[model samples]
Target: MIVRNCNRCGAAITFVRTKKGKAMPCDAQAMPYRVAPGGPVNIMKPDGELVRGYWLESGTGDGVGYRPHWASCRTP
Candidate 1:
């Protein structure tokens, strides 16, 4: 999946990878998801870099950060 961002208004545009690494449109276009940290996750314009990885806690004291990009968003 990919999250593309809007350069003019900072809106997030989400996309999912298809059969050949092609990103296709999805629900995020109508209702872009916002981040818990007061902002939203999005992909960089032109290059479409990931803005932040979104993850929901499974249980208490999960203490993630196992993968290098796991906690790519915040210090959760």
Candidate 2:
């Protein structure tokens, strides 16, 4: 599992497995970001304790993403 989040906007994230069977996060949802060495990241756990490791940039042109650049944990 990947611990990803957005620094600009505080948000948790969930990913869906691609049809190709790849566990890739949704760019339109949690935009994967470029990690900086030893830099801090956002949290995504229920208590917001899980440290996020990445953020995917999405909805650049449209200005509105399907799920936005930030999100919470997976749903039921």
Candidate 3:
């Protein structure tokens, strides 16, 4: 992951390249998440895999993952 700051909100982030070779800016911190396909949220795994789910900030989860920076960008 290549670390950088969000251009809109200036939050720390890292780029995760998708299988299609698209680079996505994701939050630097990793959070636990549960698998919920067709859910309302999307998370990027450390290996660049994208999954649909919700953040598990304080409980058990399917795995740990990162959220796209745009989700929390303040200036967007």
The TM-scores of all predictions, comma-separated, are: 0.23, 0.24, 0.86
The collision pairs in model 1 are: 3-43
How well does candidate 2 score on lDDT at residue 2? 51
- Over 4 Å off, model 3: none
Which residue runs does candidate 1 get wrong by more than 4 Å?
1-4, 25-76
The global C-alpha lDDT for each of the candidates, from Candidate 1 onward, is 0.35, 0.38, 0.86
Report how far residue 3 has shifted in candidate 3, in Å: 2.1
Better-scoring candidate (TM-score), 2 or 3: 3
Which candidate model has the greater lDDT, 1 or 2? 2
State how far residue 51 of model 1 sits from its true place (Å). 27
Number of residue pairs clashing in candidate 1, backbone atoms closer than 3 angstroms, sequence gap of 3 or more or interchain = 1
Task: Score residue 13 of candidate 3 by CA lDDT.
Answer: 92
Q: lDDT tens string, model 1, 1-76? A: 4666544444454555544566544334322222333333432222332334333345322122121122132322
Model 2 CA lDDT for position 9: 45
lDDT of 3 by residue, 37-62 (tens): 89789999877899998897687688
Where is the poorest 10-residue window by lDDT in model 3? 1-10
- Most TM-score-accurate candidate: 3
Q: Report the C-alpha lDDT of model 2 over 1-76, residue by residue, as the tens digit.
A: 3545644443444454544554434333433343333535542322222343444454332122123223443443
